[model samples]
Target: MLTYFRQRYPTRIEIDEDGNTVEVPLSDPMLEAKLHIALSTDGRHWFPLNANEPVWDQWMRDPYVRRGPDGVWRILTTGTTDGYNRDASGPGCFFASSKDLIHWNDERTLPLMEEVRDASGNFLANNIWAPEWFYDEENEEYILIWSSSFKDAGWKESRLWYSKTKDWKNFTPAKVFFEPPYSVIDGTLLKHENAYYLFHKEEEFGAKTGERRAIRLATSKKLEGPYQIVDGDLNDGQIVPVITEGPTIIEDPENSGWLLYYDYCMTNRYGASFSKDFLNWEILDDVHFPADARHGCVSKISSEEARTLINEYNISSSTDK
Candidate 1:
């Protein structure tokens, strides 16, 4: 199942002072900033459920869905109370659980950043976004990672923060998970063999420094760690191009390699890269996604599960052949 957020922009046409009509984009209070689920036989083409309406009607974005060890599906999203008033600062993200993909419950804010503090007991996080779940089979615990900016840094720089939790109800104090010299966000983890590969976005766009807004990689021997940046001939350490974010990696269904999908925000299109090893990647062509699909994660679903969601949402005709 492919889970994403559908962004809606309502516009109104008005006569300007120069007597010419112009279409002005208006803000949506809801922002249509809710979770939408879709089904795809192949990862390229997607058919939206609920007639392209949001499956979960909540003001959240960047939905990451994963089934826990208990066989229950859980989703974590960037949470905000008022969609219009949202900024680069927030208290925490939101969480929801589901037995089946059709019905979700236990929706509430995680309040993760409330526990993040500096040595002087000062809470420095101004914004929290893109919380991802990684189950550490070695440690038998779950790690929740997200990005945050600091009050001390004037919220200009961001880094990945993480916490350990055995149960979803309780979490250890948040600590810096990965902090490079530059700002980073939207981290997704892939564990291969004994190493963990973190694919994330470098948020810097300094023209003089030639820093492009693109996705880069870092790997570590441990889950929470001193991750070293993988820099070499792999596009000079950047796998994807500029203006790409919200990366979700999944294994190729054909068992040939791995597929990494990211949101090309500037072009409103989804881009993909193919990789066998974590170090090298090839940008793929001929990938297609649902119109207006924004930042979200992709998970493989069984044939029965796909049929269940399609029947429940009554979107049989929407599926692409």
Candidate 2:
């Protein structure tokens, strides 16, 4: 029992007419849905760059964001603001920028550039999930790594694809990064020590994919490479998660360790853990605290610091409790 230690912040907040903090509600029906977004931080509390706006586009799940060279934050996600209509089977990838993590502007239709149409010239009408944008400083371009099932591609046969973009306005043709011989999804790539490594969920058998998914690692010496798994492997590492999807690694700001965030299951819930290195993960069991909202990605904030923020942000919470 001691292996699991969860602290659920079963409380709610009330904002005033001016959109400022006002009172605390004992219960928040909006909790789960409100916690809906794949919340991120500018190094603090988890939040949406622009939550609930027309520009948002799609279901907006599995977020991959990074700060660009100019200290400007750029976000690329699976879906757009309006999300995917039935006509469009895939939630298209998009670009949004924010100086801070709270406010964001869509680079899709307005301000930034036009939408990325497909080869048919009708725009891609299929599934493209977990998009990772990689910046090549030397090439002065951005490359996209995404899980796509476009044009007759089957879910069980999912593959990773790549494309190039220079000004965020134009995108070149996309081709299969590696799409064969295995059921691989959620291709998250990382550049480490001058090598580029891509991680994906490898299925042993059957179409059932989930939190129990195995994370397979592949590497290429150059950006453009014949990417190969470490030892022709299919996620045979002892530390890397199996049945775990969406592997995101953040280097611990305080030390050399890396904190990894990934999906524990469906339903708005997930888990947090830290790794001494990228290979293994130690789950922060029952370590829940007052997150900015329910189901939001728990930020780097510790339980103690979260308590402080809750006390500070929603003072009336205790009264309602």
TM-scores, one per candidate: 0.85, 0.62
For 84-173, candidate 2 gives per-residue lDDT tens digits of 323432245655787644467765521111134556655443556566777888798988877655444324456787788877777776
| Least well predicted 10-residue stretch by lDDT in candidate 2 | 1-10
- What's the CA error at residue 13 for candidate 1, in Å? 25
lDDT of 2: 0.49
Q: Tell me, by TM-score, which candidate is best.
A: 1
* Candidate that would win on lDDT: 1
Model 1 residue 99 CA deviation (Å) reads 0.4
